[model samples]
Target: MSSEAFRAGDRPVRISVQIAPQHLPIAELRDAAVHAEDLGVDMVMNWDHFYPLSGDPDGLHFEAWTQLAQWAEATERVELGPLVNCNSYRNPNLQADMARTVDHISGGRFVFGTGSGWAQRDYDEYGYPFGTVGSRLDALAHDLPIVRDRWTRLNPAPVRRIPILIGGAGEQKTLRIVAEHADIWHSFVAPDELGRKLDVLQRHAETVGRDVADIEIGNELRGADDAKAAALFDAGVRLFTIGVSGPEIDWAPVERWVRWRDAKNG
Candidate 1:
């Protein structure tokens, strides 16, 4: 996180859309990506998972990085990447290479969002070690530096310093990692919970000689309510993402968020 605090006045609000890759055809996902970009979203995201998180466990799903490669080539403006990739799914070096390639494909429009692995089913079904939470977070702690180093060493290095977004709220371990590595911090907590977590993250930043303000706060827009979005914006969250899951992709909520974003920016 950077140390420059965001002034409490008017700031540009960014809206993002997360497409559930599981349950939607590639064509439909592509269409959604185009729609999101046309609708003026700041970024578009997809989750990294082998199986569907809802509806059916064995439903249609796509791999994260592979889909991102396609997305990077398909869209022209909106930044794209996983909402948060699992650190356990791939070796850090490989992940860095893949991300670098996608960054080039997108002409430098990529955000690398990653986190400690969770979801026991993803690990078990994919033959990855379904270790305890503590152990997985420990692995993530060790891998971040390796990923960073590999990113620096890769040939045709990333177009720019790709922003790193870390998603998690583990005060003791996860926030510390965010302080050390993240340019954006995503969480699903309520306003008060987010405030507390921000405090913890700030302390970690201080301990690491980093500034918490460098990290952009991210959250999901659960509804089209202006009041709710305003509360979140006032809490220091500039990047707000709303998720649309398939068989049918809904854009109404997304449109509302976009309108809210425009209002804030205007």
Candidate 2:
């Protein structure tokens, strides 16, 4: 798929909330997912980390995929998945089957966002090999196909073709993988920087004989206002996400962005 192909489709503006699985109780996480859906966000995401990323290293934390299963059942209208599941953590086939079950649980609303593992602590604590970035990327490249294959072989297949979302912007390996496989590509780049990264992605897509435009561009929403959002929109980003970590989630920005998405999509 090419950039033109993606642009040819009706890519509407969408808002996603990343309910960070740290510093909160499971019930709070559940409520947060429910509330984000109630407020009309398009999707809800969680990060795949066994440990907290900020404040106390050993704060209240929860597993990503398991909790997402809960979110799938708890929410009626929002899409649910991890923003990027670590490819290194679980076998690709198992991951695929898990994704299939979750898609079933959600009536086919799972986005299988994934990436090469990065956090050394996640590997250290869990006893997985903490390899170099290149090695991890290599592993991701190798396993992704198997995941897709397994999705086909499952007994009762996914309710729909689960969208594969690849996160990160490593110009060489990562973007190339995105060009070849992802239905969505996510990154945390600024609007000014997004164009260049996208240009790189496009070149990679051309090399891979796929349409860069077919991959929906996704970005984070912290420090973003209407102007910034517009700039990113101009750069081809349609999925805007905000991260909320909690004892209590602040829904003010979610409400604001949901309105922004509605106005734009409408």
Model 1 scores worst on lDDT over the 10 consecutive residues at 1-10
What digit string (tens of lDDT, one per residue) describes model 2 on residues 1-266?
23344592369988999989999889888998998898999999999999998768899999999999999999888888998899999999999999999999999999999999899999999999988999999999999999999999999999999999999999999999999999999999888888788888888999989967778999989868888888888878889999888866788999999888888877
- Per-residue CA lDDT of model 1 for 123-224, tens digit only, reads 988899888888988999899899889988988899989999999888899989999999888888777566677778888889999966667888888763
| Candidate 2 local lDDT, residue 228 | 89
lDDT of 1 at 89: 94
Error of 2 at 217 (Å): 0.4
lDDT per model vs. reference: 0.86, 0.90
The per-prediction tally of clashing pairs is: 1, 8
- Name the candidate that leads on lDDT: 2
Off by over 4 Å in 1: 1-11
Off by over 4 Å in 2: 1-9
